[model samples]
Target: MTGTATLCTVTAPLTLFAAELGMDEGRIGLLSGIMPFFQALGILSLPVVLRFGSRSVATTALTMRYVFLGLFLIVPFFAARPDAVFGVLMAAMLGFAVCRSLAEAAISPWSQEFMPRSVRGRITGRMALAYVPVALGVSWAIQAWLDGRTGLDRFVPVFAVGIVIGIAGALMLLGLRGGRAADSNAPRRRSLTEPLRDRNFVIYLFASALQSIVFVSISLFLILFFRDRLGMSSGALVLLVALIPVGAAAGNVTAGWFVDRYGTRAIRTALQAGQIGLLLALPLLEPDVPAAGALVPLAFFLFGFLFQAGIAVGTVYMLNVIPPASKEEYTALHYSMDGLAGGLATFAAGFLLAWIGAGEVSVLGVDLGKYEVLFLVAAGLTVISALAYSRLHEEGALSVRDFVGHFTTGNPMKALWGINRYASRTSEDRRRDLAFQFGGVGSLLAKEELIAALRDPSFDVRHEAIRALGHISAHPAVLNALETVLEYDGLVELRYAALGSLGRLKATSCAPRIAQFMEDPNPLLRARAARSLGEIGDLSSLPRIRTMLHDDPDLDCRLAATSALGKLKDRASMPGLVDLYLEQASDRTNRVAEPRSKVVLLAITKIFRCEEEFSHQWRREEVQSGLAMPQILLQLAGRVRTGAPGASAKLRELTSDYNAEDTAATLAALAELLPALHQSRHRDSDLAVDVLNEVRTAAEPHPALLVAMAAILNRIFAA
Candidate 1:
């Protein structure tokens, strides 16, 4: 019952909200029709909500829906001034659309979280049935109430009723529940940046967003075709509009059931083909033929039904591809892409409608509406989307042996042959199970698999091999295999992974060769090379590394330098590290008003702490007098002040052996450094006191050192 009310509130206003605003029936049709454009924008935020947990986000979205719907109702009260009221109403509509989009985003994942996979489709389909009846009822009620009345007065009551219904719907949804818990024995939090690197997920999102644009175009404009082009009366138009929900409901149920029985690929392909057929025939139907008008409702129902089913299947498809831990980020990336595409599509549809004139055009012996061209174009997009969808192989469907041979050897043709041969003989699920077995067979076999994968023709197989190599890091042969591809692979991602693998292997022999890649034209390649260099920690390459710090265009490279320098722990690089820190501090001060720049400053501070620790280690080493220990200690003291949490413990440990005589001489010379190191910024005060106590103990052994230690300690304690 709750789900039914929610669907009613969601789809009903979309049916006639534009009409209430006094838009030319055609423009109103397009206006109300394209609300999904703005709705897509809200959808992009889904990942964020999902990451935080759906329950909280859903409640928040529902509350916002109430606010927006209330504002929508109030717009009619101020309708004496049409333009202002319409503008306000449109704003309200946008707000409501965003809330509903949020609701859709949350519900899909929430449904997945709670429902069993086998029954998920059926349950979602059943829930969707609520929308059909609500849409029909709302359309009938609005058309009936407006039959004899004219002007804004009669419409005000309709909007008022909508507002009340919206509120009730929101309240009901707020009481519904299910969400992922933060403490569920899930894997450790993934790096927030990782999911963006997923190629399949990225492609899937692009296809999904494109699909949303197609649906939005059809939904927003279909009603106008019935009323204006078909010349359907208000009552007939209401019935026609109502059929969309019926069709959508049926599609949802059937698609869900089919998906449970047949899998995503089959359902998606069938529905997309069905949609193409419906779209192609839509333009041929004539308004004068009463039967032709009836076909419009059938067409609407088919498009609506199939579109929803495709979306449901696609959602399942996405969940299957992405790791469960990364679902939120994947969802976010998906919705963000959807929002962007939907917005662009809506804007494009407006221009298209105006350009093509939305009426009949004679082309290649066939009469078609400009709207039909839009549908044809949409059909073309569906084809493209389906093609992209076909590329997603089920997880673990390829053996490690097959993956490696195809990807590493750069022969994808052979890989595709193998996959097709395998597919012909085995079920996809069984093939996937075999693939997992291959993954578990240890690194040597995995290495062999990767080598074989390199010879395969499919990019998907090749890419999968690269990922598996990262996991099966026990093989030194894997490094050589990756390096072989690095010089020849067409994909930059493959090249980057190869470089990263070399670093992961700690292959010092590859250091010089890897350093050469730092000069690559691609910034990402250069950054990868720099990071790999840090991992190898070969000081012989420090000169080249230093050159990159200054010459590389990427900040990631510079950050990698700090990391590399920390690994090398070479005292000679201390000056360079200090200069980098000072440069960052200066940049921060110059851009003090920018929060993002301040974050850069924070990153720089972290690097400086690394430098400080390196210097501390150097001070503990036995070095000749020529090396200026006083100057080094003075610089090191300055670091302990602004360094991160554990600096005090480190400072005390390193300074414990300081000579009382050297301390006395340094205290006077390093008086300025003393107060900075002892500043309250060091959270571990006991460590600070210990440093002072060591200085006091040193004072007992040498009187002059005692004076110097006292002077230094006094300055530090006072500060």
Candidate 2:
């Protein structure tokens, strides 16, 4: 249906059609202004939308929009005067606007509510991929058809086809599952003033109003600027127009992924800044110059891309910030706001263009035309909008600087590079490009290319290839490749990566090969091998690991060995682990010794399942004074007990450095738990109560004690 709509009403044809009907710039602007005003009126139909559901409202409205569009296309044939033709077109446009506005108002809330939050951006992005090609083809075809025909003869068949196609599109909507009534309650009736009251929304409202005022001329005058100012032929103009949809499609697809990954605020703000940059470049584009063909299309493509991308991301952001109950109201209010601003802006632009009367004016030695003035104003308004957007907060949002850095360095560029190798001077460079480009978790689509790269002679190529394959480890080809690389690859780093990947994937079949690397000369490789063995849960390698734990001179190797012993539940290694801990525990003078001591103690706790006893051991040793062991123990205890209920809240209280006396008091109380739990097979209720009392007595109780205290009480209550 959207394809059909594109066929009937690509903006170029409508603007051209108005010109063919002898409409002046002011009349065209007035015609363009009619739709937004009707759209604003359409918002008042909220009660109607609520009475019937969104799907129903959208279907009905979309059907009516096409109906009027079909009528508008045909009505011109019967009109004798250009005024008669303009009047009928205006009425058709008004009808179309009413339908379009209702559809727009309901669709946002309906779609947002229907889709799960986790996959909405992904699904929307994928849908955009489909939307772009269809739109580009349809728009290209429509323009090509219009450019081929003389006069207004092109309208009849084009709009007729559109009506048929649009009806089919409307039918497809019947299958869509819109509202999940159970998940959300129906919205209550509220005054229209509610949305206007929000500070953020109000700020955004002003920004949007400014932008609407700025862009009112663009939709009305851009085609004229190209045809009249640039002297572009209709065929060439169609091609230029096609670039807009092409850029828009690409933008929507990419915007979905970024909006989902980075959060909405970053995407919205960056795209706004992007538009500012594009606007700044507009004056530099002298399309009338003999060599300006590429520049012309490039300008349209980038502006279309950034503008559409910003719209897509901004829509998602609005959906997120608005609550479920008020989504309909907020969306309607936004449309109305745009309509009011657009109408006024359109009239003002028309008046300004009329006053300027098609001649160039010099302002500060630069040639200023009405189009240039409008674009510059739009750019200025966009700056304000971007500033207003900066105040928005969303979880997981990147700052503008971080967003730019990530885009320049991340997978978006990788995808772009895959399409065109950006200045690769060597085969090795190309291979490296393919490696990072296709190395992500979802890069299985590039499996064959990645597999081929694995055979490349470049070590960097092979290393990155191995790492990329590891990311998609669940793929059978990738898994087999990693296993082969680990066993037969000549590069040690590649084999080491494969070993770690296999460990992360828990490839128990690779255990024997990993065990061989346990004695590798490279200490990092040996440590990783031991860690993999533990992760694979292969107890057969326990003795070899214990030997490493006892004899490995390398700190990392010994630490990895102790970690393996702990993971394997090897209680026999507990004495060695405890010895390792105690040796480092009293070395208060060595900063490095304290962390390793904690790791050793943690290993003991992991093996014995006696975290309380271990926590106390470190805490009591600190009572000797001027040692950091107590703080380290508190951190370790906090980590070890993270699974307990309210554990996070407890850690916050305990770890805060605001009150040193309270922190020490809470730690002192918590230190009593290990002995109490170890002494009785069953928990001693009196001892639990005493510990709780001690914690409660502190001026500000530490959260760590609250957690330990809860564990003691639960054990006591269970007994």
Best by TM-score: 2
Model 2: weakest 10-residue lDDT segment is: 701-710
RMSD of 1: 26.4
What are the per-residue Cα lDDT tens digits for candidate 1 across 320-434?
5666666665665575566557656766775677666746767788886677878788889988887776665654233223434334442344433443444355554544443
Root-mean-square deviation of Cα positions for candidate 2 versus the true structure, in angstroms: 20.0
**Per-model RMSD to reference:** 26.4, 20.0
Error in Å for residue 563 of model 2: 24
What tens-digit string does per-residue lDDT give for candidate 2 at 156-218?
A: 677777777887787687789874322235447645677877877777666665555555556
